[model samples]
Target: MKAGTNLEKILESGKFAVTAEAGPPKGTSAAVIQRKAEMLRHCCDAVNITDNQTAIVRMSSLAGCVIARQAGVEPVMQMVVRDRNRLALQADILGAIALGVGNFLCLSGDHQKFGNHPQAKGVFDIDSIQLIQMMKQMRDEKKFLNGDEISGDVPMYIGAAANPFADPFEYRVKRLAKKVKAGVDFIQTQAVYDVPRFARYMKMACDMGLDKKVHVLAGVIPIRSLGMARYMRDYVSGVTVPDEIITRLEKAEKAKEEGVKIILDIIEQLKEIPGVHGIHIMAVGWEDIVQEMVEKAGLMPRPVL
Candidate 1:
């Protein structure tokens, strides 16, 4: 198959596009990573390789993306500027593009204090917005951050993160609008459990004109157990699980089955939302469940554009 950036095509097609994330292991072994990527390749438009996800050390995102690409899977190279300066970020982008990873997700990343390396320093060298601006400069102006002209520009399908369920939910939409104004091609939101609230937020986005300007991929993370549900409720910021879901999970005879059913319900409702561009399923370790959700939701294969 001819390699192409499905993310760009997804945006242009004006239809929903599905994407999923795969976190590379901490060690050098690519066996688990490759297996997961291959499993999700046919189910999603592209697979995102998380970079040092949650500030925990992991295989390099670029290397993982390259391995996925070699396996006939389109890769989204995640670039977290939280630990690197502008120079390092720029260099990694160029290298990834050369290695055939055309999609990029810009993140500020989690604070190091939350990770195992509590003593390690955090570098917010540039906030996510600034990083997006820098990427625009490199792509549109063909100039380095130091003002030197580059031989060529890097082509990337730019993506950014959003949390619609964050506290003071109204403010999250406003922030997302700012990201869209800052030239974000797409917005993959934080995990969503409250469809009603998410629907309202989608309306807000449409009202702000963001719906027309940028694609929005609703994030979904399946809750495997009651512990997982509670962790999200109490610990994970920007994720809201209703009492109804908790009740269902608590009463379930089989936790995984209940979790998958809940995700299917979420996806079904999301498919009816007008401004929803697609779903980005974050299965975490349950990557295998993605196909079941996609199949259950009746999301067809990537429609030719």
Candidate 2:
């Protein structure tokens, strides 16, 4: 049992795991994180604290994890390659472990051009796969990236992201295979609005036996309005919002209710997919809806691991 985190245990115990995202506030208030943690504590097995998601600076994910842990919710802290070099990355990994953060989601973060500080330079010293390999080495081999010996256990459950809806669809599964080979313990994919395309990606992954190698959690975002749906369809890279869904939203009197129904339906379909181990709800700023979504999707009463 790697890391022995509640998330890892829930997956290992063969129960369908549910995870949700909680982005830290732009300011330095720990109270905001505590409130978000309280909201998500019972709705999911673990909560993901994002690391400067979209390249926008926020309270550190490590600090957010510590706050979430204090608030009685397990946190999966995100580590992005765009902001820190290997040395800094290693330092933070050690710090996070010492602070009792047991789960990690490695990412090659969005470009700085997309964030609030567009002029900021990105520090992509290592990509996500290298970060995964480095963490695996630290945890399993008790050694640093340069082959230095580690003095203590670096226990962690490592995770990475996948985008089945990305271009050159055939390469998507192959990329996932690479991450699995690089020692990713779990994966949370890009928001899945086009279920058939994602299903095909999963089918290809299952055919290659990748599912046995790592846990795959389908990502879902509940759209709140027609504008949100269109934006996701047109602007969000690696996310495909189907035209039918857009039309449905356009015709609906209550777009929010329709959006909830769409996610509930997606959850049902995701549960039947052979390779999917669970779902990761990523309702970025609209965290208040997560509990209701989980309950409506029948994912409540998360396992006591």
Candidate 3:
């Protein structure tokens, strides 16, 4: 399983592991995050702590994961190369491990221009694939990125993001296979409102036998209203929401409920697909309704840690 946490055990046991994510607050406040994590206490296997998501400064992911752990939620800390050089990245990993954190999600963060501080210089010393390789080296080889010896233990259940709907779609699966070869233990996809497309991508991954080597959790974000759906379809890059789904949301009298239903349907369909291992739910600000969504989708009552 390459890990020692409940999240790793759940995935290692071939269970339908459920995970959720919450963007850390911009301030020192912890009440809202704690409350939201507590709401998912018994319903999820892990909660991803995003690192400076959208390039906007916020609470550090390592600290957020510690908070989540105290609140009874396992955390998969996210690390992005856009904000850190190798030294900072490696040091943070060791620090996180010292703090009892085990899981990680590597990413090439959104460009700085999209963030609040556009003038800030961005750092991309390594891409996501290289980041995964670096982490593997630290854990398996017991050496730093510079090949220096490390005395103590460093282990991780590594994860990486995949975008099935991205442009030049033919290359997406290949990129995923490279990541798996680079020691990615799991894959959490981009927001998927178009399951058929994602399934096709999975088929390619399965054909190449990537699925056998890594766990894949299809990403989904429940749309709260018609406007939300439209915005995602139009403005969200690397995500494609079919017009039919938007129409369904628009015509429904209870949009919020309908949105939940839509996610539930996606889960049901994903379960039948060949390569999908689980679902990664990201409701953004709608954290309060996650329990309802998980229950309606038949994923509640997660196995005891």
**Global Cα lDDT for candidate 3:** 0.89
Local accuracy of candidate 1 as per-residue lDDT tens digits, 1-305:
11247877876677788999999998999887889987898888888899998889999999999999988788888888778999899999889988988888999898887777888878888899888778777877888877888786578788899888877877978988888877788888888899999999999999988888888999999888989998999888668999899999989999879988998889888888978989998989899888878878888665655
TM-score of 3: 0.98
- After TM-score superposition, what is the CA distance of residue 110 in candidate 1 from its true location, in Å? 1.0
Tens-place lDDT per residue, model 2, 147-233, is 999889999999999999888988989999999999999999999988998899999999999989999999999888889999989
Better of 1 and 2 by TM-score: 2
Cα miss at 50, model 2 (Å)? 0.6
Candidate 1 stretches greater than 4 Å from native: 1-4
How much lDDT does each candidate structure score?
Answer: 0.86, 0.94, 0.89
After best superposition, candidate 3 residue 239: deviation in angstroms? 1.0
In model 2, the Cα lDDT at residue 39 comes to: 88
Point to the candidate with the largest lDDT.
2
Question: Looking at model 1, which ten-residue stretch has the lowest summed lDDT?
Answer: 1-10
Writing each residue's lDDT as its tens digit, candidate 3 over 128-192 gives 99999999999999899999998899979999999999979999999999999999988999988
TM-scores vs. true structure, each candidate: 0.96, 0.99, 0.98
Q: Least lDDT summed over 10 consecutive residues: which range in candidate 2? A: 296-305
